[model samples]
Target: METRIDEIGPGIYRLSTYVADIAPPAGFTFNQFLLLGDEPLLFHTGLRRMFPGIHAAMARVMDPARLRWITFGHVEADECGAMNEWLRVAPQAQVAHGRTGCFVSLNDLADRAPRPLADGETIDLGNGKRVSYLDTPHVPHGWEAGLFFEESSGTLLCGDLFTQLGNGSTLTDGDIVGPAIAAEDMFRSSSLNPNMGATIRRLADLQPQRLALMHGPSFEGDAAAALMALAADYDQRLKAA
Candidate 1:
């Protein structure tokens, strides 16, 4: 398995590793976003075993040890399994997440204490890169789930939201909503509830120019429409359930 690196946004890089064993014919891609600035931030750490490839991919763009902030959408293995490994390498790095995540999991999970941000709190990475954390508990699955919006690039580092089964392009102006719903039908990965659709709709308010997905290709072009379409699907699924 080789990890491919691509700059999806101005300074946001996607480090993706495709694993053929996960979903057979289509397979799956585990992606991690690297935001470069005065203080670089890495979103999603991939799996614990994926550290070497991910680290190597990260090194291609910038020194891995220069990473300052580590964060993810939730506490899943694929989301933050290599938390300690990262901290071990980047001595100055600290895991930052929503207050609920820190209070419930990251406080004890992280080697160094984490910085918990309130909803809507933004972290200035310098060079005009700023990320705001939004609490979205149980929207996809985890109770401490949250997402980040990079204000400068209008990019949303949305983890596991538009997950699909494929080793497609690093970035595309394609339809991700259909593939995502198909994957959801197969995996039943999302926590289906009344708030699921509403939570996703709230993200559409960001009007993100690009969506930095964790499993599938990074999407560009009419991201808000795609998000709204996905939300509508979730709402229909809830009614059908």
Candidate 2:
């Protein structure tokens, strides 16, 4: 599997790897986002086995050792399986996540101590690139789940929010909510709690211009509307449940 790199937003690069064997027929894509700045940050470490390809893909744009912050949506293999690997390579990099994530897993899992972020906390990457973290406990899955929003580019580094199957375009303005719902039906990946819709609606309030998704193609244009639609779907699902 070859990892493809694309700049989904200003200073934000997406490294996508498509594996055909995972889901058969259509396959699945594991994506990671690299945000460059004075202090470069990498969201999602992919899998530990995928480090080589993702590392090479990242080196094409910037040195992997330059990474300053390592983070993910939650404590999952696909989300942060290569966390220690990254810390080993980028000596200066620290794992930053919500306080619960750090306390529950990262404190013992990380090779080095991690920096705990409070809800709505912002990390300045310098060069006008700032990312704010918001706790989204169990919205998607894990109690430690969270996401980041890049202020400068209006890009939301959404983790597993709009997860869809197949390796589609690197970026699209088309319908992602539909594909995401289909995937949700197939995998039942989300937590599906009453607060799920409300938490997602909170993200919609960000009015993100771009959504940097973890599983499928990154989306551009009318992100808030797409988010609302997804929220509505979750609400309906909760009612059905």
Off by over 4 Å in 2: none
Compared with the true structure, the alpha-carbon lDDT of candidate 1 equals: 0.94
lDDT of model 2, residue 44: 99
Q: Once model 1 is optimally superposed onto the true structure by TM-score, how far is the C-alpha of residue 201 displaced, in angstroms?
A: 1.0
Tell me how many clashing residue pairs each candidate has. 0, 0
Clashing pairs in 2: none
For residues 39-147, could you state the per-residue lDDT of candidate 2 as single tens digits? Answer: 9999999899999999999999999999999999999999999999999999999999999999999999999999999999999999999999999999799999999
Q: State TM-scores per candidate.
A: 0.99, 0.99
- Model 1 C-alpha lDDT per residue in residues 1-241, reported as the tens digit of each score: 7888999989899999999999899999999999999999999988889999999999999999999999999999999999999999999999999999999999999999999999999999999999999999997999999999999899999898999998988899989999999999999999988898889999999999999999999999999999999999999999999
Q: After superposition, how far is residue 174 of candidate 2 from its true place, in Å?
A: 0.2
Off by over 4 Å in 1: none
Instruction: Look at candidate 1 and give me any clashing residue pairs.
Output: none
Model 2 superposed RMSD (Cα): 0.6
